[model samples]
Target: MSRLYVILDVFADKALAGNPLAVVLDASGLDAAAMQRIAREFNLSETVFLLPPEDEDRKARVRIFTPQRELPFAGHPTVGAAALLGLMEAMAGKGREATFEIEEAVGAIACRTVASGKRAGRATFDLPRLPQPSGAAPDAAAVAAALGLAPGDVGFEGHAPSRFDAGNAFCFVPLAGLDALARAAADPGRWRTAFGGDLGAFLYTRETADPALAFRARMLSPGIGEDPATGSAAAAFAGAVMTFDRPADGEHLLRIGQGYEMGRPSVIELGLVVRDGALSAASIGGAAVVVAEGTLFLP
Candidate 1:
């Protein structure tokens, strides 16, 4: 048997930048084990399998997987899949813009996609779940040690270590500046002590490589190493932003810079809607470029 798949660079307008995702089209026959194996074969940050929607009203059912495990929800995959689907529709002479729903392990995600001719597109999805504190994070000193930074480089202003989940969880760590962020690296020996057993650490700084961006970030994990762009982490970080920044009751837009150090610079657009000083809604948006398409053979 064979499957159709497309490789895309999510959060990037160009090829070979941002977080690369492999999207398997019409993955109805494959089981979870097979999906996992295929994900490992692709060996990208994440791979998504598109199946027929259980609810006919939805556009598709999306299953996201890392090299090691399946994820309930993932940001880049969702964005990339939506963009690709939109491009397919456009090429079929349907339309350039589309609004649809995609079912994931977490729930139904509402997506809006704008196709750019044949090669690239932008997608935005409303978060099915709001960000919530998952658990207590390790102290700043321990986190600093795990990231190979001094204790003093751990936080900035009112930010400290915290855990949040918007389907996927991450330990959000705020660094003092870009200098500390640049120096930070995950030390395997100390990683578990700081972020616990499964949570990856999302290190961020107010200083960005691009001054136009609101923040600079890096995602490091024992399993995945460094991710060029992390949409789920950006989604979860909304909780930390609300707690610390406390934006007035209105819609706010933030641009995050990531992957510069890895030479695949990327940008993530996060929109937060606040009401009465509380986060009411949030969305993640980014551009994805289709880089390659191929057939995958399977037994």
Candidate 2:
């Protein structure tokens, strides 16, 4: 059997700068094991399989997978799939902007997309669930050892190691500066001790390469040593920002730059709606470009 798939650079500032994602449109008959195999075959950070929505009112049901396992919800896949669907409609003489719901393992996700060009688009989605502390995070010294950094280099401005989960869980590590962020590399043997999972650590710093951006970050897991961009982490990071920044009640926007250390610079826009010193809503938005399309054949 042959299935249609689209490859996209999601959350990119340009053509190839962001995280790459593969969207399989003809996933009617694929099973869980098959999807995992396909994700491994693509070898990208994640692959999205678009199936008929369980609810007719929704647009689609998207299944997200890493080479390792399935995810209930993911940031880049949601953005990329939404943008691609909207762009496809526009290319077929339909409208430019669309609002739809996507059903995932996590829940129904609300997404909006605007076509930017023939092959480019932008997407934003409401947070299905607000981030909350997952559990106790390891101490600064333990986190520092996992990242091969000194304990003093592990934290900044009272921002220490913390764990949170929006859809997926991640340990957020704040470094002292961009230099410390750049110097971070997961010590394979010690990583599991610190984060306790494959999707382990999200390291960030207040310092950024782009002066206009709010922060710089890097995501490191066990199998995937470093991720170019991590939307799920960013979604969960809302908790961190809200906890520390204590912004005045209103809508606020933040830009996070990532993947520079690996040469794939990507930008992620995060929006927070705070009211009464509490978070009312959060959003993640970014640009995506359709890079390639092809058919997948299986025996």
**Best lDDT among the predictions, by candidate number:** 1
Question: In candidate 2, residue 14 scores what lDDT?
Answer: 72
TM-score of each model, paired residue for residue: 0.98, 0.96
- Cα lDDT tens digits, model 2, 178-237, are 989888888888877777665568888998857889999999876678888888899999
The candidate 2 region of ten consecutive residues with least summed lDDT is 191-200
TM-score of 2: 0.96
lDDT of 1 by residue, 1-299 (tens): 88899999999999989989999998998899999999999999899999999999999999999998999999999999999989988898889999999999999999999998698999999999999999886789999998889999988888989999998899999999999989998889988887877588989999885778999999998777899999999999999999888999999999999999899999999999999989999999999999999999888
Candidates' lDDT values, in order?
Answer: 0.92, 0.90
Residue 23 deviation, candidate 1, in Å? Answer: 0.8
Which candidate wins on TM-score? 1
What is the total number of backbone clashes in candidate 2?
0
Task: Give the distance in Å from residue 124's predicted Cα in candidate 2 to where it truly belongs.
Answer: 0.5
